[model samples]
Target: MIRIGKSVIVLVLLLLAARPHVYAQATDVVALTPTDDLLTALRIESSLSVFIDSLHHRTVRDIQVMPFSPVGRAVPNAGYTSEQARANPIWLRFRVQNATNKPIPLFVRVNFWCFESLQLFVTQTPEKTSAQTGSEALIRLLPPRVSRAVSTTAVDSLPGLLAASPVVGWRTPVAARPVHNRHFFFPVTVPAGADYTVYLRTLKVRGAQVVPVSLLRQAAYETWMQRDYLFWGGVLMTLLFVSLMSFFFFITTRDPIYWTYLLCVICLIGFMVINNGFLNQFAPSVQFWLPRQNCYFLFPLLLFYSNLVFVRTFLPLKKTPLRWLHRLSAGVLLAGLFCVLMLVVENWVQLSSPVEMAFLRLFTLFYWLPMPVMAAYVVMSLYRRYYRSAAWLYLVAITPFYILNFGQVVANFGLIPTYRPLVNFDIYAATGLFEVLALTFGLAYRYKLMRDNSDRLLSSQREQERTTFATEVQTLAQKNSLLEERERIARDLHDNVGAQLAFMITSLLHIGRQVEQQPIVNGKIQAEQLRTIVGYARDAIRTLRETIWAIQQERFTLAEFEERLNQYVNRYVQQTNGLDVVVEVEGDSGQPLTSAQVLNLFRIVQEALSNVVQHARATEATVRLQTQPNGTFCLTIQDNGQGLNFSPDDADNGERHYGISNMKRRTEELGASFRIYANAGTVVEARREAEMAN
Candidate 1:
């Protein structure tokens, strides 16, 4: 059946080609007649033939001939002669005939030249021959053997030939009239021997035999042409708008997708302009330079590049077979660019054949093949990645453009002839609109990602800060614990050890008093021992008081501390007999010491005093407290009589008492130095470093 249909179409096309002059018979003819018999005698006979061709691919059918003749001809005495016959007025009559089996209601259109002075008079039937005296003709419709004249009156008349120009005469709407089934006629007159031609063109349908079919087809084609121009113009304008926007966006944003889109739109508009003959109408020079071959090459390259950019942005085909496809597209584009450059250099003018042109267009179809696969990949990837509704929306946005563009391609390649009219529809317009919408959606998606990421980062930062703050609080708590422990230890030592020593001192004094009046042999030795023991007790009490003071707060100045120390030492000296003690104060004694350092100094002094009274039975003891220029305090206790000949072995063998060891330990704990040596006498000295004021 397909083969039969194909063969029938081929035969019809051949038949159409065989009859080129068939359209010439459908024009309206005009004849001129004279009013006077003298001018009629000079009348010459002439005939005119005109040809009309259908622009679209169609065969003209059911030819209608409309002829009109003039009412009167020029008279010699009426300021017109034989020389005016060339410019004389003419009128014509119309006739319709049907050669097919079906009846046809004819619509006769009389179009006359403005300068020919032609006029139309429609009657029921036209007369067969010219009448010498009348201004009317008989018209009739005859079926095979029967013919009848309807009237002999004129419907309208003109004075002279119309000015030499095109003119529109009588036109009738396509109305349903009697189906003649055979033939019909109406007639008018024209100037004798005047040369004139008429043009007859079919309306719309190709090879439509029925009159109604032809008329309806003609009206439809006209309407279609009008709509086609409007739709195509609107699409071209829209493409131009998007192209400008894309260009501007590319300029501002420097995004490759915008540039690719701009180029695509430009190519799309070029294809539209060239295909619709707008390029031929407005820029015919450029049209000569461009043809179907160029369109084919340009369209595919633009499409491929645009797809690549979109895929890179929307789909991110950075790996796998998709990546290979992108590379292949790039290679094809480069080859196309090279071809364009060669064409420019070599001035290659036109495509060799329609097949080559078709091949070039076929490349566009090939270019489109990757898009569906790419879109599917994108959809799958985005779905797996959970990109909300963006993936789906993007696919929807892209689908229409894909379909329209590919549909246009199919139409251009004649894959579907019915879709040929849609070839000029702005697929690019639809495509561009969709692309812009898709880009907007993509930006929204990016914005969502950015916002989510920002939120996460802020949450993480808050968590980290909370951890840091908690760590700091823990460290502070630990430090407070250590400080409280130190205070407790200081308080315990002051209360316990200090009370015991005070009680012992009281007991010793009471014993001394009791034994004073007896005058026993060892009474003096006993008194001295009691006194030394009492001195040791006093020193212990002073040391405990200083420790409590150290723990309470900070210490007083060096001058005040020294004065208090001197008074204590003097009281000790007065109580003990057989001892001379001298106290000396030097330098600026007003320098301050820390509470801990003061406590260490007091203990060291107490240890030295005990040592003096217990071990040194010498006659004189000197105590000195001095402040030095180097921000330090020095305390010294020296004995002038009977310096001990202490051996290194004796000190090492534990001969040296714990008083000296304790003093050294206390001084060292306070960040001071303690030394024992003979400096003109046995000297015990402790030195403490002080903080310098800023």
Candidate 2:
């Protein structure tokens, strides 16, 4: 009686479990039906769970299961709240039952794009606990077949294409795959019968992991892929266009800011390519880096640090009170450099992988924390400095990133509803575009400001030069008037005083001869005194003539001065009665002499000549003036004379030093060197170079 009870109980339990499967088959809880020339599939509600296998046994029956809630937050849109689960290897269970008139051969398309090591299982009906084989057994059952490529036309007749079981595999390595239309397709045979359960196991998953599981007809999946590719192609085209334009501006403007901005934009583009799964699509090997979070560390480091430098270059912080901001920006740049080194060591140096990864992750977090703060500070400082337009540009540039990162942060923590379309799009690229445009305009404005400042400075300098020129002209006119007065006095002395002295000397000579003829003693002494007076008058007349000649001219060129020296020497030699004089002018000085220089040079030559004629008592004299190759003017006066008959004591007592003193003083005033020696004769030499224009 006990055995009969056990059998009846078993039959009742089987019937009870079978009832729901029958109802599910009739009501279509999760089945993909072909309609509108596309595959329409619905997921079974609340059938997801995490597979926890604590025991050493790896069999499917030994696996422990927990309920899987993909989204744990309260969703007002869905009118429900679900409990969150920790990141773990998850399992999804779903059933497909065909309630149509014919057998449906449809493939299951699971967008396990963001998952790793996913395994799909199909059975007529899942038992409470069943011993299972490994994934190879399933691979063997659904072997790859030579299936025809799917076309859009085939989607309308999906029922006909669903005859054979579909092959299940991966386009890239399972580890690095992220959801970007990289769906896993599993072909199934769902005839008009009981339901079949499908199992998806994802291992070692992390975060608010989303598994976009769906079922699709093969033709419909292909059509969807074409559309997806087209959309991404458009995005790529836009990025390329913007990048090219940035470089073009950089080339034209020659600004480092534009180049840095361009690099930041390109890095952003690269990041989107990696994040959106396009890089993995092309090179599946990149999946290895995803496990290490290199995608998070590398590209963002480039973009963020490049932006920092770009901001520094854009702002006028170097000479401003807010220059400290530039230093902080530099510190951020150094930190970024350190992060780059850490990433390189982690990825390529083959170090202790865990430690390297930890360093990279920590640095990445720290780096981003200061970035927005720095940007905000830059904007506020610019505004404070009255760079309002630049501040507006900065605000525009950073707004999109602010929205994106903030929204992503809140959504990841389940603080807000995750808006997939907004979060998934490359908002950084959009922000980068705006920033590049705004900065380009700002740079243009800066250039204009520089140009205006330069023009103003030039005008001020020209005005200053004009004022100086006017002052110099007035001073020169006053100097010329003073010189004219001196010339007038010299002419009066030469014409009147000079003639009177000559006439007095002649009258004294005549009276002396007449007194000598009469022979009276007192008269003889008086006549002797008169003859001495006549001699003194003739000496005075010679001195007066020289003074008059010197004060006559306003200027004397080197050639004219040499001519005057020759004429004076010839006249003095004639008066000396047998003194032979040689005057030679040699070489040409292309530069002209100023009035002061000419006066000083002429006076120096005059003193040398007077000393030779009056005191040297030389029978032969030569005055040679020449210009050296280096523009030095040299004058030498030599005479075969009773050379300076004076001792060192005589010079110290200021005896016979008048002419030497005058020559030295004039030479010093002209910035020339003077030398005198009593060798063959009292030789005097003066050397000078032309002065440069003021």
Candidate 3:
């Protein structure tokens, strides 16, 4: 028993899937009154009266006489498509009772205008219970029944092809519609206090999307159109703004992401404009017809393709499932383009029929169905990383459209039944506007971050260049200072070696002449002259050694300077005939001095000692080193000899006080001071103060 019940349930489920989903299929008479200004056919019982000519090639007269199943399915109120979707055309017929004091003029409107033909047929007079007579209206009364054997060839021999009211719809140009709108409106006037029947004829009428029909007063129809246009127009403006803004950014930064984003929006706008029926109403017929006829899927296919490119460029899709989605979208794009090429060639070759074209257009949705499922993974993956705030905003902006798009895809594939509210393109339009506008803000933020990073890199490069320039300047300055110091050392060598050698050679020559003339002088005379020459040679060697040492070092500490000074003075005292010198250092501050400072300071001490021996005629000399406050070094050389007087006039005298001037000049070279004054003995003091620290 259980197995039988399960099998029966399975059979029932298969039957339901195989059947056409339709609802509210019965048509009834609608009563009209003066108080009713506007109404939609969706909610009323009788407004849904429609008949399908299963064989699409039928005349208006044949349809009027054929039995219209009073049970007719309305567009939105009905579930979805029925057995008569693309292959057959439908005729809509409804009865309305005019209960007003005057004849009621009603407009029967079909809200889409893509049909190849639309004709209006109505009874000329209101029927009273089974019969009524009035010869006033333009149309004749329709018969209750049509003969199946009525010959179409016999009817063509008559006066008109229609054999009914004048045809109007796309057969009449869009500009010549009764209301001249995006929708088809046919006027129906019912005489007061009577009933009349109306019919709207359509051929090749199905659209890519569902179409809505409404019945309203003339004023109400115009007002309703204004509101609809206003809403869609605002959406257009928002999308246009996004396109312009992204294009401007692409120009400024030349980022391919922005360029792709602009392309996506442009394609979206084009697709939506055509899909919304705005282009059908406003565009020139020849210019507009070719695209829908040939490359109908171009804009929408390009839209999804560009969107995939934008996602790949702006986000890291590598090593993920979304990468496959990108590839699939690419395939769809190429297929759609190829399909367009084939359509363009249809003028020469009958590659496919209109029915096949419709099927192919809808079948492309199979490629896009997996996109929403994959998008869920991408959104959740991106959400976990709050750092990618830009991509997150992009996903947030498109989330609504993704939901609607999922519904659209499922409906197109017949996996779910379509309803006007769920499957209409108008909802897509609103969400599309929201997506582009929000993505614009995200693009701006992303650009700002890129620009800031660029600026920081540029600033760091400039700072590095400045530092390099400063280092180069410092190196050049040091080279110049070294060259100057080498030149000073050469001059010192000249003074010690060249001048002393010349004087020694002259004195030796005179001693040799004296020895030669005397011939029998004591051994003491020859020996004394030889010893004098040796003393001069030793002094030259000592001076040469000090210059060499100072030149080798770049810097000298105070302790090293003091120790070297002491060694030199001891050697000098031994060379001088029995001259006694005492060296005393009072301070031991570990101060650093430049090589030039020590060299020049040591030379000043040497000059002062020479004066003590040569000019002061002193037997004993004292060399004292003292550290003054604030990093100053004071060197004093005093002798207990008859004091010598200092005179500026003597300094200028030719070579009279050359040693005095040399000491002063050397002290000045150290950027210090030199003083010569008599205390109980003659004192020569040179003071050097340290420079301020940076």
* TM-scores for candidates 1 onward, in order: 0.35, 0.47, 0.70
Across 570-596, the per-residue lDDT of candidate 2 in tens digits comes to: 665545456777888787634455455
Best by TM-score: 3
List candidate 3 segments past 4 Å from native.
1-52, 58-86, 91-113, 119-173, 185-202, 205-209, 215-217, 220-230, 285-292, 316-333, 352-394, 421-425, 496-592, 609-613, 616-694
Candidate 1 vs candidate 3: which has greater lDDT? 3
Q: Is candidate 1 or candidate 3 better by TM-score?
A: 3
Candidate 2 least-lDDT 10 residues: 73-82
Supply the TM-score for candidate 3. Answer: 0.70
Q: Rank the candidates by TM-score, best first.
A: 3, 2, 1
Clashing pairs in 2: 105-162, 113-178, 113-179, 114-179, 166-187
Writing each residue's lDDT as its tens digit, candidate 3 over 1-694 gives 3343346345535533553354445566668776775644323433545567667666544654677654333243221232123545567766667778888666776655355556666543233433322222223222212212224454343322222344554434566656677667776666778666656665542233333555666656667777888888888888888889889999989998899899889989988876556666777464344533333445555666567667656664555655665566556557555645644554555434555555454545433633553364345455555325654565567766765665555555555544444445678887888788778877888889888988998898888889888888988888887887887787677766767888889989998788778885478867888888898898788888889899887887778988888788777663544568887876654777788877887887788888787778789898887775465777889999898667533555667777777777777766667778887789988777677210
Write the number of the candidate with greater TM-score, choosing between 2 and 3: 3
Quantify all predictions' global Cα lDDT against the true fold.
Answer: 0.46, 0.55, 0.64
